[model samples]
Target: MQIIIINGPNLNLLGKREPEVYGHQTFEDYFEQLKTTCSDVELHYFQSNHEGALIDKLHEVGFSYDGIVVNLAGYTHTSVALADAIAAIPAPVVEVHISNIHAREAFRHHTYTGAKCKGIISGLGLKGYEFAVKYLQEL
Candidate 1:
């Protein structure tokens, strides 16, 4: 199976941004472990701090990939265009959040993108990507 992980904004700073909530492990490290654990699957990862870049990537891979695991970070709550991009795609998308948005500030509690996803995984740290990949593998 083929799957792509699309992370947005500040996520490139996973290891250093906020160790308290996002954990100390870099996403690159975790992605390596994930690739090792799911060795049979072809996994690809893309991260962008720009909303339009993310949308373009979704448009690029959304048609041919088996599935997509996306964590739009702050854009999840604010970007209607990103949500529209997800909704416009053919691949199933699973939204992930390293920290529990519901447990954070009130503004973080709502999601414009998650509503367009196949399902969502939250408060599970980087492992949420694994779960999402596995879920898509089953489909």
Candidate 2:
């Protein structure tokens, strides 16, 4: 099966941004580990600092992928457009977060995209991505 991993704003700076919370792994490290763990599946990864680019990528890959694992990052709490795109996709979406938003800022507690996702994973650092990949493999 083919799965797409989508990351949004600030994720490209993962290892450097806030190593204390998001962990010390770079995006390449995370992707390589995910590839190793989900060897049976084809993983397509994408990240963008721009919201429109992310939305466009979602629309472009939506029908072709079997599933999508998204860490919408800051968009999760703010982007209704991203949520709508996720809702429009034919593939199952697993929303992930490095930190537990609910336990962080009050503003981070709400997600406009979670309701559109098939499942949500958070507070597990980079492991959250691995879990989402495994969840998609199971399906």
Candidate 3:
């Protein structure tokens, strides 16, 4: 299976951003661990701070990839275009959030992309991406 992990805005600071909420491990470290565990599958990762770049990437792989694990991050509450991009894609998208949206501020409680996803995994840390890969592998 080919899975693409699409992370957005400020996520590049994963290790240093917020140790309490996002943990101390960088996403790259966790991604390597994921690759080790899911050796049978092909995993790809992309991260960008730009909204249009993300949409472009979604459009690029959305149809060809087997599955997509996207953490739209701050865009989750703001980008309808991203939601539409996911909706337009054939790949099953599973939204992931390292921090629980429900447990945070009211503004973070809403997600424009969740409805467009096949499922959502929240507050599961980097492991959420691993779970998403596994879920897609089953298909």
Q: Order the numbered candidates by TM-score, best leading.
A: 1, 3, 2
Candidate 3 stretches with Cα past 4 Å from truth are none
lDDT of 2 by residue, 1-139 (tens): 9999999999999889988888888988879977988899999899999999999999998998999999999999999999999999898999999998889999999999998999999898888988998998898
My TM-score estimates for the predictions, one after another, are 0.98, 0.97, 0.98
Q: Is candidate 1 or candidate 2 better by TM-score?
A: 1
Regions of candidate 1 where Cα sits further than 4 Å from its true position: none
- Pairs with steric clashes in candidate 2: none
Error of 3 at 59 (Å): 0.2
Candidate 1 contains a number of clashing pairs equal to: 0
Q: Rank the candidate models, highest lDDT first.
A: 1, 3, 2
* Candidate 1 vs candidate 3, lDDT winner: 1
The C-alpha lDDT values of all candidates are 0.95, 0.92, 0.94
Which scores higher on lDDT, 1 or 2? 1
- Colliding residue pairs in candidate 3: none
Model 1 over residues 13-83: C-alpha lDDT tens digits? Answer: 98999899999999999999999999989999999999999999999999999999999999999999999
Locate the minimum summed-lDDT window of 10 residues in model 1.
Answer: 124-133
- Candidate 3 displacement at residue 120 in angstroms: 0.5
